[model samples]
Target: MKPFPKFARQALALMIASVPLFPVAQAATAAEWPTKPVRIIVAAPPGGTADILARIFAHELQSPLGQPLIVDNKAGAAGTIGVHGLLSAPRDGYTFLLVQKGIVSEVPQVMKVTYDPFKDLVPLAQLTRQGLILVGKPGLPARNLGELVTYIKANPGKVDYANFGAGMRGHTMGVQFNRLAGVTAGAVSYKGSPPALQDVMGGHVPLMFDGPATSLPFIRSKQLKAFAIAYPKRIPALPDVPTFAELGFPDLKEVSWMALWSAPGVPPAVLARMREATLKVMQSPEVQKKIEDLGMEIGSAATSEELARDARESSERQGKLLRSINFTPD
Candidate 1:
C-alpha cells in the first residue's frame, strides 16, 4: 500500500483520536435527558386498565426522572392510533408507549394494522399483570363456571358475552372456553373494555371476560359475579373464586400483562436509563401495594430482550388458539 499524504495522515490520526469521545458525549447527553416533560402514549380510552396503569406509573416516575411524565390516550384502530402518535413524535427520547400484550400479540393476528410491532417498536420493560375473569351480571342465575356452561347450553340463542374488541385476548379466551366446555354464547363486541363493561353491568350483555383491574370492585360490591379466573391459582383478592385450572380448564390459565415500549431508533443510553428507572419504581413497596390493591400483580424483572421473547411466544400461542376455533375477524 502507498503511504498516505501528510495532510491525509494527520486527518486520519485526528479521526481515530476523536472516536472514543463520541460515546462519552452520547452517554453524558443521555444522562441529562428529559430536560423537558416525557409523554407516555396509551392506546386505549381512559378509565380502562391500560390508562389506569399508565397514569399510575407516570405519576410515580416523575420524581425519579426529574421531569413531569404525561400519559396521552390515543384510543382507536386497535392501538394503531397510539403507535402512530409515538412514531410521529420527535424521537428525542421523550415519547414512549404503554400498552397491553394484545396490541402487539393478538390484534395483528386478525386485523390488518398500519404498523408491524416487531419492526416498528422496541420493548423496554414489562409492567403490571392480571388474568382475565369470567363475570356475569349480578342477577344471572349461574353461580360458577359449571353452572354458567349449563345455562349457556340451556339458553342457546338467548345468551351472549361482551368482549372489549374483536380478536382481543378476552374474546379469544371466551371462545376457547366455550369450545372446551361444549357450549356456545354469542359474542358482542365493543370498542374497549369500559363500554363493554358498562353494557354488562347494565344487564344488556349477560356475561363478559374482563381484567381484574376493572372488574374487582364490582365483584366485591356484588354488582358482578365472578365465575372463574384464568390464572394459575386463585388470586388473594377474590379467594372465594377458583382458577380455570381448578375448574378443569387448565388451558385457560394464561395471564395478560402490560409493557412499556418505544419507537425504533431510540438511543441505547436513553433506553438503558428508562429501563433502570422503571424497574426501580416498580420495586417500591408503595407502588407494589397500589398495584396489588388493583387486583394486579407486579410485573416481572425481565430484560427488554426477554420481554420481546415472551411477546413472540404469546403471539404464537394466540395464533394456535385462534386457528383451533376457526375464528376469522370481520
Candidate 2:
C-alpha cells in the first residue's frame, strides 16, 4: 500500500484508539442503567397489601439496580389513574409498576382504559398470589354467607360492600359473589383496602371483600367478622372461617395476585438483568418468609408470556363476572 500522509496516520490512530473506548463507555452505562433513584409506582394508597408488597420488592431491588428504589403512590379512579400515570412516564426500565393483576386484568372490562395494559407495560415478574377474605362489620345482622345473602335479599340496596377500587379483585369478587348468592347490594369504592376496610370496621359500610393480610388485623381484633374466604381452602390464620368452595361456590376458588412490570420497550439486556435480580430477591428465604407471613403465596415461577396470557384470559373472565351482576360504572 502507498505510504499514508502524516496527518492521515495520526487521525487513523486516534480513530482506532477511541473506537474501542466508546463501546466500553456505552457498556458501562448499560450495566449501570439506573444510576439515579428508581421509582416503583403503587397504584393504591399506602397501608394496603399492594403498597406493602411494593415496599418489600423495592427494598430488595435497590441492591440489584444499584440505586435506591422509591415507592410512588398514585391512588384514584379505581387504579385507572395510576395506570395512566405509569404509561405517561418514559418507557425507561427505571420506572416500574408494582400493582395487582386485577387492575390490568379486571379493571379494563368494566369501563375503559386509555392504553392497552398488556402492550404498554411489559411483565417482569409475578410477586404474590393469595386469597382475599369476605368480612362484614362486627354488627351486621348475618354471621355467615347464607345469612348475609338472605339479609341482602331482604334489604336490597340498603346495604353496601366496600372495595379498594372499582373492577379490581375485591370488586369483582364482591359482585360475583352477590350474583351467585342471588342478592343485590351496593358497592363503595376507595383508594385502597385499608380505607375501605376501615369503613366496614367502623360500621360505615356493611361488608367488604378484601385481601387476607389487610383484613387479618381487624378480623383478629373482632372489628370485622370473617364470613368466608375466597380460596379453595381455609388459611391457618383464620381456621374458623369457611372457604367459599366449602360453602358450595366452587367457581369462587380464584386467588387475587400482584405482579411487577416495566414500561414498554425496555432493552432486552436490561429486561434480562431485571428478571435475574427479581428472581434472586424472590428466592431468598427471608423474602419468602416475609411474603408468607403477609398471607401471600410467592409466584416467582411465572414467565412473562404466562403473565400476559393470564391477564388476557382473566380480563375476559372478570368481564363476564361483572356483566352477570349487571355492573356498569356510572
Candidate 3:
C-alpha cells in the first residue's frame, strides 16, 4: 500500500475542510421535536464498535433532545437485521441507524440484502472516524508487520485470517491485506466477532483486523499480537503499534466512519433537529473525553451530502479492492 504524496494529502484535507459545516434545511427547535423517547438502532452486538459508540453517543445526545435515547441492539446478518427492523418503524425521526459506514459501503458488495442502503435510510451525521488494528496470535512467528508479511508469504495459504462475515469490514481488510501484503492466507469467516476472536486466541486463525474496543483487552492480556493499525496515524490507545503507512503501505490508509441517519420519509425539520442535536453532542467535553478513551478522533461530514459522498467513495474503493482479489460470494 502506497501512502498518498504530500500534495495529494494536503489537497484532500483542504477540500474536506472547505465544505460548509451544515446543510441548508429547515430545523425545528429541539423543544418541539422528540415528544417521546428516541431509539438508536445499533446494528451490531452489544459490545462491538457500532454498539459501544452508539451507546456513548446516545448517553450524550439525550440531554439536548430532552428525551431518552435508547441504544437498541438488533444484531445479526451482517447488521441488516437491525436495519430491516427500521423499515417497519414510522419514518418520524424517532428511529435511525447508528452504524459503521462499512455496513452500507461493503456489505452490499459481498452478500444479498433485503434493503438498499441509499434508498431505505437517509444520511444524517458522521460522528467519529478511526482505524482498525491487524492482530495476530502471540505465538505466531512474525513479531511485527514486516515479519508477518514475510512469514505469511513463506507459508502461503497455510496461515489463516479471520473475518466476521463475507462482506464486513474484517473481510474487506483481509482482502486488502492479501493484496497489499503480497501473501496468501486462507480466510476463516465466522458468524460474529466472538467466535472469530475465540479462534484467534486459540490460534486456529492467526490474524484479524479488529476495532480497538474489543481487541485491546486481549492484546494487553498477551492473548493476541498487534501487527499494525489500518490508518495513516498511530493511535494513542495502541501507541506501540505502527500504522500501515508508517511501515510503507501508503495506499492502505483507509479509516472507518461511524454515521447516524434517519429512516426514509422523516420530515426534513425532524431530520434537522436530529442532526443539530448530534452535532452538539460531538462537541461536548464529556463526549470528547469518552471518544478519546475509545481511541478515536471526531470526524467531519456534518452535512448529509458530505456523509453520502464519503460513503460512496468508500464503497467505490472497497469494490475496487474486492475486484483485485477476484471475490464473489453467494
Candidate maximizing TM-score: 1
Best by lDDT: 1
- Of models 2 and 3, which has the larger lDDT? 3
lDDT of 2 by residue, 118-180 (tens): 788767888887888889999888878888888989987898889877766777787778778
Q: Candidate 1, 102: how far from true, in Å?
A: 1.0
Q: Which stretches of candidate 1 lie over 4 Å from their true place?
A: 1-21
Better candidate by lDDT, 1 or 3 = 1
Error of 3 at 246 (Å): 0.9
Worst ten in a row by lDDT for model 1: 321-330
Q: Write the per-residue lDDT of candidate 1 for residues 228-298, one digit (tens) a residue.
A: 99988777788898999988999998778888989888888888889899999998998898888888888
Error of 3 at 245 (Å): 0.4
Once superposed on the true structure, which residue ranges of model 2 sit more than 4 Å away at CA? Answer: 1-29, 32-34, 141-143, 146-160, 186-192
Ten-residue stretch with the least lDDT total in model 2: 321-330
* Estimated TM-score for each candidate: 0.90, 0.82, 0.86
lDDT of 2 at 190: 87
lDDT, candidate 2, residue 189?
87
